[model samples]
Target: MKNQTKWKISTLISLICLIIPFSIYSLWIYVFNLGTTQAERVSVFKDYFPDFLDGRWSTTIFSIIFSISAVILSSINLKHLKKIWKLINIIILILSGILLFLNLFSMM
Candidate 1:
């Protein structure tokens, strides 16, 4: 049972690392529409993104890299993992909250 738990944790860490890169790639594909035209983009994937979004891919890509690195580091240094995760969560939560607020304000 204990070994299974450890394996689950290890798998989780790997999965988390992959998610960040995958999200960034998805966002990149959304913004650039690389190898895809406007008419094709909508047919391919329009439901995932907000209609209001201006496609700022650079910001999102950097954020993904930073987030993934933070998680990987925390996983390695389990002793400080809680503190690191808290900080990361707070930063992302506040940033997203501010973005959502500003967007709503702009629309109003």
Candidate 2:
């Protein structure tokens, strides 16, 4: 019972971590209009948040870090999760991996 509860909690945390990068990317592309050109996107970030160090790259780096963390958290309790939760965690893990790859690729 206790182990199940712990796995549930970890699954929830993993979900939240997975959501963060997606939300940030969505906001950047939709709300902020991640512009058509690289220079335009950089300008948008600069205009909105000048304090960030290389705003676009900084966000990408943060997303990579969060996605890595999510992958770790999601993997921790995979064997202990209930059927539905296990499925969800697996999806989250896959998405986190995709996000990690996308972020890394964008940096190149």
Candidate 3:
């Protein structure tokens, strides 16, 4: 039971690590733009946000998909646990955190 709870909490943390950043980022762009076209949104973020969001919508879509998948799989099947996978999960979580910190409320 303890293990399950720990794993569940860890998984939830991982999900938040992914979702919160992406949500804040997309919302940041949408909020600033309010109702702009694709090109306009890209231009604004490029000028202000200054990241891949400017170069390609494909990049945005890719990040969103991967982040969402990581969130979903956090609570998924635990039967296949392996050391390598755990390390990878940690890396993914850290990357998500970095993205989140970089995007919103960082100023750092």
Candidate 4:
């Protein structure tokens, strides 16, 4: 019982980690689509999430970290979870992989 509970908590944490990057990217796209000019769009985005645009690689770094952690957690819990949870964990794993790939590719 206790072990199963631990896996459940890990699964939830993994799902949350997976969500962070997707939400961030979605907001990024929304911000990117706003404004009439490049500078204007950047200024708007900077106004909201200045750390991401400060040249410190905050977005990329956080995305990669969260995605990787989600992937790890999900993979570890995949075999332990039952039906619906197994499905959710698989989805998390796949999305995390994609997020990790995009972040790594963007860095290159």
Candidate 5:
């Protein structure tokens, strides 16, 4: 396949990998009352938080990794889209990392 085709495919896959989990996580947090302020969420979940919450952090990390990979792949063959894909992937990566960090530190 051509480099452009490879970049497009990898970018699409990585973008999906980044989005799908966060979508599911948002839904999960909504359902579990963890969508609001960190203090509020912590208070609510402190009594009976499920084991799966821990895994959500792992999922977010994986999503960040995928986004980073996509950025790298996109960087290699950025002949068409140029800055758009790279900017988007970078934003997603940073936001996901911030969210993960906040969630982890909120417990302390």
Candidate 6:
């Protein structure tokens, strides 16, 4: 009972970490597209970015940071989870890896 509760809590935490970064990125994209001009979108992100950093780099950095965090959290709980939950954790890890890969590739 207690063990199951712990797994549930960890699973919920893992799910939140998995979703939040991508949700924030998607929101950024939505807002960017809604702008009247490309300059408007660029200016908005540029205002907060350092002179040396641009949108792609900032996005890749954010993705790597958040995905690594999700990977760590999912791995910590993985062994204690049930079979179906184990599969879910594996999927999350894989997706996070893919996210990191694509982001890094874009930086090239």
Sorted on TM-score, best first, the list reads 4, 2, 6, 5, 3, 1
User: Model 4, range 1-108, lDDT digits (tens) per residue?
Assistant: 898889999999999999988987887789888888988876776676655446546777888999999999999999898988889899999999999999899788
Arranged by lDDT with the best first, the candidates are 4, 2, 6, 3, 5, 1
Which pairs of residues collide in model 2?
none
Between prediction 2 and prediction 3, the one with superior lDDT is 2
Q: Model 2, range 58-93, lDDT digits (tens) per residue? A: 878888888999999999868788799999899999
* Off by more than 4 A, model 2: 31-38, 46-56
Clashes of each: 0, 0, 0, 0, 0, 0
Of 1 and 5, the candidate ahead on TM-score is: 5
TM-score (C-alpha, index-matched) for candidate 3: 0.41
Query: Which segments of candidate 1 are over 4 A away from where they belong?
Result: 34-108
RMSD of 3: 10.6
- Give the whole-model CA lDDT for all candidates, comma-separated: 0.48, 0.82, 0.56, 0.87, 0.54, 0.73
Strongest candidate by lDDT: 4
TM-score of each: 0.33, 0.82, 0.41, 0.87, 0.46, 0.65
Q: Which residue ranges in model 3 land beyond 4 Å of their true spot?
A: 17-38, 48-54, 58-62, 75-108
Q: Looking at model 4, which ten-residue stretch has the lowest summed lDDT?
A: 48-57
Q: Name the top TM-score candidate.
A: 4
**What is the alpha-carbon lDDT for the whole of candidate 5?**
0.54
